[model samples]
Target: MTAQTAHAAPSTTAIATDTAGHGTRRKVLWGAQILLAAFLLIGSGLPKLVGQADAVETFDLIGWGQWFRYVTGVIEVTGAIGLLIPRLAGLAATGLIGLMAGAILTQILVIDPAWSALPAAFAIVFATIAYDRRTETRQVLRSLKR
Candidate 1:
């Protein structure tokens, strides 16, 4: 193998790393995204939107006021919807990861530490989705540059 041939492979890697075997992987990601979206929209976001007792109380403990709850609900709902959009899933998952981090911190600091488990679990799932869709995320960013 010539030095030229050895170096040529590295140059093609960027353009060649397409979704050759990501069909099954992507399907799995979609499944997770759907489930998470439903969970967030129904179990979490809606409760905050409607001022469910538990949600209201939790935010109360955080001492951020009920308005913060509304903002959080909006972010959750928006992120959930974005998860279902193929082009936005990566960015959506990335955003959710950040939201979950805040939740985890709140739970540990102001609320029950045990409650942190839920958000931590959610963050892990979002991380996986974000990682899987990174290439798509990059493509989206590239398009936005125009």
Candidate 2:
């Protein structure tokens, strides 16, 4: 006499279908994040890089000089590119969050309190992205630990 029990594993077809759905959702979210990054790069980063009058004036008001403007512009451009990369998106968002926080503080103390709202909104957006991609960020950190 023999006793046997059968355990059923998930079908490959079902697993593939579930994975496809997740991929589609991720693609949509990535597209939206890239679009927002493009806007930030073009609208804010470009002006700072080119020494646009307003950007220069704002940096002057911040008392950080033109060098700071260039540095911030470079960081913004880099972060924008990083946002398009799946492995780097969360880290990019984290950096942008810091940048936007500084912008918000600058607006409140040096510029105008009313001007802070835009940067505050940007910070929130970056935070959302970072939180959403936290798993990827943790993976990156773990890899770096080695």
In model 2, which range of ten residues has the least summed lDDT?
1-10
Residue clash pairs of candidate 1: none
Per-model CA lDDT versus the true structure: 0.92, 0.88
Off by over 4 Å in 1: 1-21
**Tens-digit lDDT track of model 1 for 51-137:** 999999888889999999999999999999999998899999999999999999998998889999999999999999999989989
Distance from true position, residue 32, model 1, in Å?
A: 0.8
Return the TM-score for each candidate structure: 0.83, 0.79
Tell how far residue 35 is off in model 1, in angstroms. 0.5
Position 115, candidate 1: lDDT: 94
As a whole number from 0 to 100, the lDDT of residue 10 in candidate 2 is: 70
